[model samples]
Target: MKNKEKIGFMCAYTPLALIDAAGYAPYRILPSEACEDRAGHLLHDNLCPNIKKILDRALAGDVPDLAGVVFVNSCDAMRRLADAWQHVRKDDRIIWIDLPSSIDAMAHAYVQGQVEQMGRTLLSWSGSPMDPMAVEKSITSFNRICAHLSELAPAFASGAIPGGYAAMQALYNKASTRDFTTTLEEIEPMPGKTPAPKHDAVPVYLFGNVLPDPKAFDMFESCGAMIADADFCTGSRLFSPVTGGQKDVYSRLTSHLMTKPQCARSFDPALPGEIAKTTLSRARAVNAAGVIGHVIKFCDPYLERLPGIREHFKKNNMPLLILEGDCTLRSMGQQRTRIEAFIEMLM
Candidate 1:
């Protein structure tokens, strides 16, 4: 990927396969550091912490040089961030897509259109039209990476391999920033590092907007909580498996984006308790003893629906623990005692 220009993308719904086919490497901008007030002049201080950190990072020159940026209008915070990005980085192409919360046919078609437009822009950037087979090959390579994670999910939760959750988190972080083919090297355990004795840690399912720091997982493990499975921007939902059988590649790819383990932004009004239902399904799949719902501060979509989600979890007899923070390890570390008590009760 040395010859390929890198394009920065934020949301999971962005069509990374298309970016790969366009002869570019996809760079996912994850705000892993503490929120800074430096971006306050660029955007509001009350905005989502993830947004603030991402903008602040760009200003600090901590980000890679990219030919373009992809942003999803999944919520007001994200939309405003895209608008402010122009002020921060004046010379890069910024592509914004309107993500629909509905999962109907109309929504699918709308996503396909957005993806195709994104494809066109990417192809133009490369100065050549991408071959259909290249797109398929790119998707196949991405699915290979996802398959690796699917196999490791059990160890990640069971604590069968000590530090498995941290290892998995590192892989996901690398998968987003580097080439998929290059990421395969670090998938397996290193040659000399031996697996530590497995302990019976309290397995818990974590669902949130973004938990990018591997140290965050380390902190949980220290508190006797093994992240058996999670639904986060930097975790399971990152590179979703794109299902086959659709002749049109865009349709197949867009379907995966729209229907993968979703964030709180999108919903089907006709389906009552959708978020609760999905959360239960995911948590039960891993046989978690309890559920942990972590949301970044000021994230309106998740915050507004949290009350309903909590009530649903309670009704179903699931032990739920809610944590709110600024998307940093410092914030998570402060809640250590609370996390320990919750894990102890489950144990």
Candidate 2:
């Protein structure tokens, strides 16, 4: 098979199945520490560090060879990042996805329409038409990937997986960049036995917008906590399966996007407390001793929802620690003392 042109995308809302159907590689543009200074100079300092890091990568010419890129208007920072990319990387084909914040009938319709439009745009860019069969094939393949990761969730929660950071890195890395078949082949052979905790580790549920540094997971482990599970866009949130029973491809795709465990930016008006409920449910499922909200600095969506998340934990008498960092190890390092304290308190 000839190497497919990579289409870089930012948010989870970007439909990878559609990208695959359009004959492009759906490479997630992850955040990194490489070009923060340059990004800060280009964009404002108060913007979300996740977006800044991505901008830095693009501006520094660190991103892989790409035919195009996609940015979802999930938040103000992301919108600004798309704007900055237009100015800095004008040569790259950039596509903006107007993601809906609410999960209602209207929102679903809007998302379905957007997905259809994105399909057409991707087809135009990649010289591939919208093939329903290709989309279905992609969906089936991705669903298998989701299944493999879902199978490992219990292992991670039970402390069976050694090196939480490495495990998470492998999980996110494969899901973001690799094809579904490759991802499945890589994970299917892993052992699933529950291992005893290396320490009497305090199990904690970690949720956030982005975790750029996997070493941050190491920091948590060093602080005497086990990341029982995570709700990061880069983590378990990617493991959601497309809901079954949809007769058509578009509806199936829309169902998958809308029903997955949502980020703070994607609201469910029907269940205003859904995000908090989902977090609490996951924490309870893993017998987590506490909850950690790790978000990038100036992430408007996560920031807006933090109060409700805090209240949910407080009402349940659960220890909740909110750590805001700038998508860099140095920023994460500064919070080590606090993280240790929180772990100690949990113990």
The number of clashing residue pairs in each candidate reads 1, 0
Q: Compared with the true structure, what per-residue lDDT tens digits does model 1 show for residues 227-297?
A: 87889987778878888689888889888878787888888789865998899888998788999888999
Q: In TM-score terms, which candidate is top? A: 1
User: For candidate 2, what is the lDDT?
Assistant: 0.79
- The residue pairs in collision within model 1 are 157-228
Alpha carbon deviation, residue 42, candidate 1 (Å): 2.2
Candidate with top lDDT is 1
TM-score of each: 0.94, 0.92
C-alpha RMSD by candidate, in order:
2.4, 2.1
Model 2, 1-347: lDDT tens digits are 23778888888877788887788778888887665468888789898888888888888888888888888878888888888988988898877677777777787788888778888889998777668899999888777777767667657645667656546556776678755555667777876545545547888888897884667777888888877778888877766777768778887888778888888888767888667778888899988999988988888878888898889989888899999988677888999999999999999
